[model samples]
Target chain A: MTDLTLTPVQTRQSHIGKAVLRWSLYILLGVFALFYLMPLFVMVTTSLKSLEEIRTGDLVALPREVTFEAWRTAWSSACTGIQCEGVRPFFWNSVLIAIPAVTLSTLLGAMNGYVIAQWRFRGANLIFSLMLFGCFIPFQVVLLPMARLLGMMGIAGTIPGLIFVHVIYGLGFTTLFFRNYYVSIPAELTKAAKVDGAGFFRIFWSIFLPLSLPIIVVTVIWQFTQIWNDFLFGVSFSQAGTQPVTVALNNIVNSTTGVKEYNVDMAAAIIAALPTLLVYVVAGKYFIRGLTAGSVKG
Target chain B: MTKWLEEHTPKLVLAPSFVAIMIFVYGFIAWTAWVSFTRSRLLPKYEIEGLIQYERLMASPRWETALNNLFVFGALFIIIAMVLGLLLAILLDQNIRTEGAIRTIYLYPMALSMIVTGTAWKWILNPGLGLEAMIRGWGFESFTFDWLVNPDMAIYTVVIAAIWQSSGFVMALFLAGLRSVDQEIIRAAQVDGIPTWRVYTAIIIPSMAPIFLSAFIVLSHLAIKSFDLVIALTGGGPGYATDLPATYMYAMAFSRGDIGQAASSAMIMMMVVFAIVVPYLYSELRSKDD
Candidate 1:
C-alpha cells in the first residue's frame, strides 16, 4: 500500500535509469557503425593507393599520396581481354538498358497495383498470388527455359530481351509495393472521384499518380540499382561488345593469370557503385519514408 | 452490370501483364520442363529419351557436388544473413548517431554488382594477397587463411562473401520492421522493469515475425539462386568444390553441350524451390484470408 502510494518517486528513479540505458545504447550503436564502415574505408584507401603500396600490404596505412591514376586506368586502359580499353564502352549499354527497363517495369507495376487495389476483379487475387509465388521460385530455375524462349523469339542475346527479362522478374516486388501503397489510400478518394464522373484512366493519371510519387521513387531507385548492378542476365543475354558495365567489371576483375591490379579493381567498383550510392544519398529520406508509408499506410 | 464490370476491369487491366508473364515466364518454365525430359544436346533438341536425363542427373558427379554445396552454402548464407541482419536492425533501432551513414555503408555492397563485390572479397580472402598475407606481414609467420584454395573450405568462403553482400538488404528490411513496432509497447515494458534484451526477445521479436519471415524467404531464395558470386570467386574450381546449381546448369548446357542434362538439373532445382515455396505460400495465403 505504501509502495503504491509512492509510485511517483519510483517513476522518477526509473526515468533516470532509462536515460542512462539510452546513452549506453548510443555507445553500442557507435561501435557497430564502425564495424560496418570499416570495409568501405579499406576499399577507398586501397583505391587511392598505388599497386606497389597495395602489394606491400600497407592496406590500413595512409597512402603515401592519393592518386587518381587507378581511376583513370580502370575507366580507360585496363584490359578486359585482348583490348586495353577499360569499362567505358559498357557504361552506355548499361544506361541504355537500365533506363527503358526501369521505366517500363515501373509503369506496368503501377498499373498492376492500381487495378488490384482499386478494382475488385475476378481472378485478381489468383493472379497476384501466382506472381507472389513466382517471386519465391529461384530465378535460376527459370533461366534455362527463359533463354530458350528468347532464342525461339529471336531476341535471345538482345538488349530488348534482357530488358524484358528484368521487367518480368522485377514485377513481383514492384507490384507488391504499389499494391500495398494503394491499399493504404482511403477508398473514399477513388469513390469521390468516381462520383464526379472520373473514369479509371483519368483517376489514375491525375489523382492516384500524383499521390504515388514516394513509391514511384522507391520503385525507380530499386529497379535502377537492380538493373544497373545486374550481371547474370547481362552476361547471359549479351556478348562481349554488348555486355553491361558489370560484365566488363567482371571480366577485368576475375581474369586469372593477368597481373592483378587491386587498385584498378577497387576504383572500378567505386565507379560502378557511384550512381546508386548517389541516388540513395539524394533520396535517403524518401526510401525510408516510402518503406514506412507502404507499411503503415496499407 | 456494374458489379460485373468492376470484377472484370481488374482482370482486363491485369491481362496484358499476365499474358506477358505467362508467355515469357511460365511458358519458358514449361519449355524448360519439356527440355529436361528430352535427351537434348547443347541448344535443346527434340529427341525424346524419356527419363534418361534424370538418370544422368542422378549419376553425374558434378550435379551431386552442386546439390551438396548448394545445401551447405544455402543454409549458412540464410542463417548468417538473418542473424547479422536482425542484429544490425536492433542496433540501428537504438536511435543511434550516424544512422544514415551506417545504413549506407552496410547497403553499399548491394549497389555494386556481384562481379565487383565478389571479386573484391576473393582478393581480400586470397591467401597470398589478402588477409593471410596481411597477417604474415604483422609477424605471424605461421598464419594461414587458405580456405579459398581448400576444396572443403571453399564453400564456406563463398558463404562469408555472400553474407557480406546480402546481410545489408536484410538489415534494411528489419530496420523498417523495427521502426514500425509500437513505441508504446517498449515504454510499457520499460515501466514494468523488463530488460531491453528481454523486451526484444519477448515483445519485439513476435511483433516483427511476419517481416522477419518475409526477409528470410527472400534471403533464402537469393541464396538458392546465387550464381555470379560463385563464378567470380572460385569459378566452381578447386575441383568443383564450390559449384552451385545455377553454375552447374550453365556448365552442362554451355560448356559441356549437354542441354538435356542441364535442363534436368534446372528442373531439379525448380522442384526443390517449389517444395520449399508452395507450402509456405499456401500458408501465407490462408493466413492473409484469415
Candidate 2:
C-alpha cells in the first residue's frame, strides 16, 4: 500500500502539514494562556497605576507611570468600614490563624494517620470513614452550631476561636493526606521497630517522623491555603480586630468609602493573595499532589 | 500498669481527634438538623416544631430563585468546565516543550482566593470602565457586556468567573488522566490505521471515566459550596437575583436574623450533597475492598 513507504515529495508535504498543525496547537494554547493570565496582569498593572490613569486609560494597558500610593494606602490607611486601618492588621491576623492551625492539624493528623494505617485497631476503618465523610459536608450546616460552640468555649470572636474552628474542620483532610501517605509504607518497618522494644511514640518518632517530611510539607501547605483564604469562618466567627484578611478585603472593596478606588481594592486583593500564591509557585507539585490526594480519595 | 499503657497508647493518641470529630462535626450537624425543624427566629429555639421552617423556605420566592439558579449554574459549570478542561489537556499533551510553564499559568488562578477572583472580575465587568468601556474605546461604541448589572444575566457572570477559577483545575486532572493511559494501547491503535481523533474518541477518553467522575464530584461539590465568589462579585445583588443557597443561608441567619430559614436551607444543601456523595463514597470503598 502507499502507506508502506512515503515518496520524497509526499514526505516533505506531510512534514509541512504536521508543522502547521503543531503551530496551530501552540497558538491555541497561547491564546488560552493569555485568557488565564489577563486578569492577573490587569490586577498588577492597575494596582501600580494612578487613579487618574485608571479612569482615563485602557483597562489592559500598561501604566503610563507606576505609582505605589495605592499599595501604601491599601496596606496601611484605607477605610474598611469605620476602621481607617487598612488590611495590614487583618493580614497579620490571617498569618497568625494559619500558622498554628496548620501545625496543630498536621501533627495530630500524623499521629492519627500513623495509628490508623499501622495498627489496624478495632473500629479504625469505621472511624476513618466517618472522618472522611466529614470532609464533604457543606460548611453552612456547621456554621451556626460552630459559632454557638465557640461562644460557649469563651473563644468566640477571637483569633483562637477561628484557629480552633479551622483545626477542627481541617482534621479530616490532614488526616486523609497523612493516612494515605502512610499506607504506602510497608508494615515491616513498624514491626521491626516494635521488635526493637520501642513504644508507640518512640517508633513514630525515630522511624515515621523522619520519613514524614513530604506529607508534612504537603499537609502544611494545604492547611495554610485553606485557612488563609477562608472567608466564611472569618466573616461569621470573627469581630473587628480578629477578622482575617479575606473578610477585611471584602469589607474594603465593598465599603462605601469616599471614592471608589479600584486601584486600592486591587492592591489589597493582591496582598491578601500573596502568601498562598508564593506557596503555590514554590511548591506547586506538592500542592497538586495534595489536591488530587485529598479530593480523589474522598 | 505498664502492660495496660502499652496496649492502649495508640488509641490514646487518636482519642482527642476522634472525640473532636464526633463532637464538632457530627454533633454539630445533629444540632443544625434539629434547629431546622423549629420556629427559631433571632436566636436558636430548642423546642422542635414540625416542618414549619421547611414549609416557609419552600414557599419563599427568593428560595425558589436560589434553587432554580443552583440547577442552572450547577449543570453549566460542570459541563463547560469538563469540556474546556479536556480540550486544554489534549492540547497540552501534544508533547509541547512549554508544557510546564503554560500549566503553571493556567493553574495560577486556582492559587488565588475566590474573593480575589471575584474582585478581579468585578472590575473587569464593571459596565463603565471595564470590558464594556474597553471595547467602546476600541471603536465598538454600541457594545455592552453589562451582565454584572443586569439581574437576569448576573448569574452567568458568576459562572464565567467560576469557570475561570476552576477549568484549569479540571485540565490538570484530565492531563494526569490522559498521561496515565497506556501508551502501547494508543500506539497499537495508531498502527491499525485508526485516525488520531478516532483513537482518542473511541479509546482514550472513554478509559478516563473514573477521572471524569472525580472531576464531576469536585466541581459539583464546589458549586454547591460556592459563596465567596458570588459575594465578592455581585454580592448576590441586583435584587438577590444571583442568590445561591449558601448566600441565602448566610443572609437569613446573619443578615435578616431568620435562623429557621437559614437552618432549613442548610439542611437542603446537605441533602443535595448527600445525594451526590453517598454513592460515590460507596463505590470508592467497595473498590478499595478489591
| Best prediction by TM-score | 2
* First chain TM-score for all predictions: 0.86, 0.98
lDDT of 1 by residue, A127-165 (tens): 888777666665655777777678888988778888888
| Number of the top lDDT candidate | 2
Docking class of 1: acceptable
Candidate 1 differs from the real structure by a C-alpha RMSD in angstroms, to one decimal, of 3.8
RMSD of each: 3.8, 1.0
Across B1-290, the per-residue lDDT of candidate 2 in tens digits comes to 99999999999988899999999888988999999999999999989899999999989999999999899999999999999999999999989899999999998888889999999999999998898999999999999899999999999999999999999999999999999999999999988889899888999999999999999999999999999999999999889999999999999989899988999999999999999998999889778869
Q: Give the i-RMS of model 2 in Å.
A: 0.6
Q: Best DockQ goes to which candidate?
A: 2
> For model 1, how does the per-residue alpha-carbon lDDT over B1-290 read when each residue is reduced to its tens digit?
98687546657778888887676567767777888888688667776769989998889888889999988999889998899889888888876667888787776566656776677777778887688888888999999999999998999989988887878778888888888899998999998879789999999989998787777666766777888889888889798999998899888766787878877888888888777667767886678769
Please give the lDDT score at residue A3 for candidate 1.
Answer: 47
Candidate 2 on A166-217: residue-level lDDT in tens?
9999999998998998998999989998898989999889889999998899
